[model samples]
Target: MKLILIRHGETEGNLNGIYQGIKDYPLSEEGKLQNLKLKSKLENINVDKVYYSTMERAKKTADAIFDFSSSAIYFEENLSFNEINFGLWDGKDYKYISKNYSEQFQSFIDDFKIFKFPEGESFKDFYNRVSEGIRKIIKVSKEEDNIAIVAHGGTIRVILCELLGFNYEGFYKFNISHGCYSLLTVCKDSAVLEFLNK
Candidate 1:
């Protein structure tokens, strides 16, 4: 089985570098250009099912891929892979959030896995959610299944930590740009990373 993990195209929040937890921002015009490039790159690829975040940006990205790729893709909105719920911090600038909630934000910067958001989920909880989703996806993969996932950077980061044998603290260490994708070849025994940020 081959798993294609893609980060959604750019949004205004992304261009502005805000913490867009679940603000439901759609893609910007420039973002659609990025998706078009990705679609051109993935033309005629084989994909069995696509599980994407329910967020608008992710769905739009998925649509672009489905339109370009020749595969008959089955799409499912899995909240399990949604971006981290920033709760009170949603739709706010990171610098602003840092200025306001300096202490809590500092704690998050120190060790995010254990830090709980004032009105949001802890990184630990987010990790568990993604893990559960991956476990199920892996369990149901047939020998020739090819899957795709359109998700946020944070969602893909946690999934990489699980697939690449890394820890949660290193989640932010990886750089996954918008409209980029990572490929993995998986079997019942092992999973191999083919390429990342393509």
Candidate 2:
């Protein structure tokens, strides 16, 4: 099976360097253009299905691909692929979080893998959610099927970590840029990254 992992296009929160988490924000004008370009690039690829986060940005990005595909593709919104819930930090900039929640911020920086955002999910929780989603995708897909996943940076990183056998703490190693797609060749026992941040 082939997996195409895509990060949603930019939003005002992204441009402003804010943590969007589960907050829903529409794509910025620049983001729309970016998705258009991505759509054109993927028009020739034969995609079998598209699984996107429930977030508006992810939905819009998935729509870009589905709308231009030559054949009908199965599409579904999966909440498990949604961005990690940031709790009170949602829509807040790093500066604000550091200033307002200094101790918690420091703890997060010290060991983010175990740090649970106040009123939100821990990294472990997020990883499990994304991993389950990936498991379902793999189980339902045929060996030759090409599956596309449209989600947030964090969500995509978690998926990559799960597939590539990386520790959850190493999720940051992947740089999933907005509107970019990474390809992976996956099997029951092993997975190989074909390309990243493309």
Which residue pairs clash within candidate 1?
A: none
Question: What digit string (tens of lDDT, one per residue) describes model 2 on residues 20-133?
Answer: 999987788888888988888787889888889989889888887676454677878899999999999998999999999999999999999999998998988988999998
**Who wins the TM-score comparison?**
2
Q: Give the Cα-based TM-score of candidate 1 against the true structure.
A: 0.94
Question: Mind giving the per-residue lDDT tens digits that candidate 1 earns over 36-117?
Answer: 9999888768788889998999999999878535456677899999999998888888889899999988998887879887
Off by over 4 Å in 1: 68-71
The predictions' CA RMSDs to the true structure, in order, are: 1.8, 1.4
lDDT of each: 0.86, 0.89
- Best prediction by lDDT: 2
* Span of ten consecutive residues with least summed lDDT in model 2: 64-73
Task: Tell me the lDDT of candidate 2.
Answer: 0.89
